[model samples]
Target: MGEFAKRHQSPWPIIVCFALNFSKVVALLSPIDFLFYLFAGFTLAAGVGVITARNPVYSVFFLIAAFLNAAALFLLAGAEFLAFILIIVYLGAVAVLFLFVVMMLDINLATVRAGFVRYLPIAAVVGGIFAAQLIIMLLIWQQSETPPTLNALGNSPMNQPNNVYALGRVLYTDYFVAFQTAGIILLIAMIGAIVLTLRPRAGIKTQVISQQVSRKSSQSVRLVDLKLGQTHPTTAATAPTEPQEGSA
Candidate 1:
């Protein structure tokens, strides 16, 4: 039976048939579906490029491209608010910040890349663990009788506002604690970053709020009583004397 199967099999025919079927399916796709596929492809490619690009600046640009494609995907999925947030927060702020930091920092690329091999094992293990968890979750979701509901306030009726309202409602209600925690964590991270980057420079003048606040008027301004047409003695010594007409 194996010999007969091997002899009878013509892989080219099967390949051609599959190709034809794929082409037919592609032809059948709506414009929206085609655009979605295009965006998905760009997103995936840009995501890969972000990690693999040698230059940090290029990596940041790739990351920004990925963010843009992701926002496009979100828009396609009808999550307009998420799309805007991704564009505004990630593309506008985070990606630009990353680019600026990468450009501004004195990073030795060779030194940074030298440790890649050393860290590869740890990265592989962590990635494997994450992949396994994702697979398990996906399996569980696929086998589950009911699909998961993201909206805690229950599915909105067709007449109601779309994903934005649903997301806000659920976020402020069901996921409020998690959202607040995330905000607090981000705030702490921002503060930590500022603290780390701040360095006191020697010989640089800086504002002294305490000194300014505690100063007496006498220390800053002296009220001098002088007879008319008499200059202060210190000022008279420092002031340039008018050139004598007879001096050579």
Candidate 2:
């Protein structure tokens, strides 16, 4: 059994050697290999911590660290603009907002788990679909062979770099309209989400913005004071005139 398992899983040394070979190619092309390694290592550690941390605060902190490291890696990958945007937009804004929301929320673990049994079937179906799709993809990819390299094209990948640079240029120039359209679609989605969250309830009353602005305070407030205490002259025992009439 041990021998079969060993055959199934490659030795640690082989895996290490394969990793070194892969990193060597990247390091050869990469100008700042040390920076990339540090960033990549930090990202990996942070990612693990984010998922495994018991405390939500620690998880959020780990996630932020991961995002920062990922941004650094993105910058190293030659997407400096995108890297900065990720830091500014996602890390700075989204992470902090989520962190605050997480801190503010008091989760009822028991109540939340009440539906787990009911939803298990649906969850299983979704999981099965995902697994099936993934297996199919792996089978297809395994069966497909690599395309033959054209010797006429440069042997070095640097000579004909991946579509990153060309894609960026086209995105900013020729496909700018399409990019804006995509942005608009995202904007619409955001608005739709906001609308969905703004559900009207029978017991809850909400004032219209236009009506609220036009509302007068005079109509809402009126001065009406009432006096409850009355003179108790007859009920008092210190009445001299009543005593004289009783004696006569």
Candidate 3:
């Protein structure tokens, strides 16, 4: 037995073979499952790339790739409505916005990373706490008696009229208050973001709405009476000239 154990020290090779064979079998059994795994792999890889990339633009691209993969996963999971919304709202709008912002910003990587070491401990602690909470929640969910259902109408998701209808019913009926609260929170966040990034710079011309609204026609327009053939000289042209020493 000792000799046999020495000959095969680890079962990793067998485990790897089994895992590959299992995945192949699942892929063959259900194409959707295969697509789900493919998208999941893409999402995971892109998510890692987002954090690891040196260039902010590359990071934003990776994040958009991750969002696209996530949308694919959502589609494979039969949440077509959510998949489309995720693609449209996140990848189409939010990711593009992030990309534009990253491209436009004059980011100094060295300056941004200067305090990385100082904040590393706190960031690590927060990340660990978040990971732990996710693990605990997942474990609790796995052990729960009720199988996960997307339906909020007391019917199984399979029996729902449609994905959009089901989601709307849930959002408006069971989670209405929560939905409104989330909207309000999002609105506040949007306002806060606008306020934080907005700065008044010298020499930048901006329209003052109050000044515009309060202005009279006389301030903007001057009716000048001139002779038929005479041209009106501008202030610069009509200004009294300082005579040079050599001139009259």
Report lDDT per candidate.
0.73, 0.68, 0.73
Judge candidate 2 at residue 13 and give its lDDT.
Answer: 52
lDDT of 2 by residue, 144-165 (tens): 6433242233332222455355
Residue range 87-166, candidate 3, lDDT tens digits: 99998899899988999997877887899999999999999999999989967874755322343345355234587887
Write the residue-wise lDDT of candidate 1 on 1-248 in tens digits: 11222343443553465468977756765566656767988999999998899898998999999999999987766667889998999888888889899999977779989999999999999999999999899678647543124433454321235767767666786678999999999999999999999988789988899977997654445455789998976546543333223222
Q: TM-scores across all candidates? A: 0.68, 0.49, 0.68
Q: How far does residue 166 in candidate 2 sit from its true spot (Å)? A: 7.2
Task: Give the Cα-based TM-score of candidate 1 against the true structure.
Answer: 0.68
Q: How high is the lDDT of residue 220 in model 3?
A: 51
Q: Mind sharing the TM-score for model 2?
A: 0.49
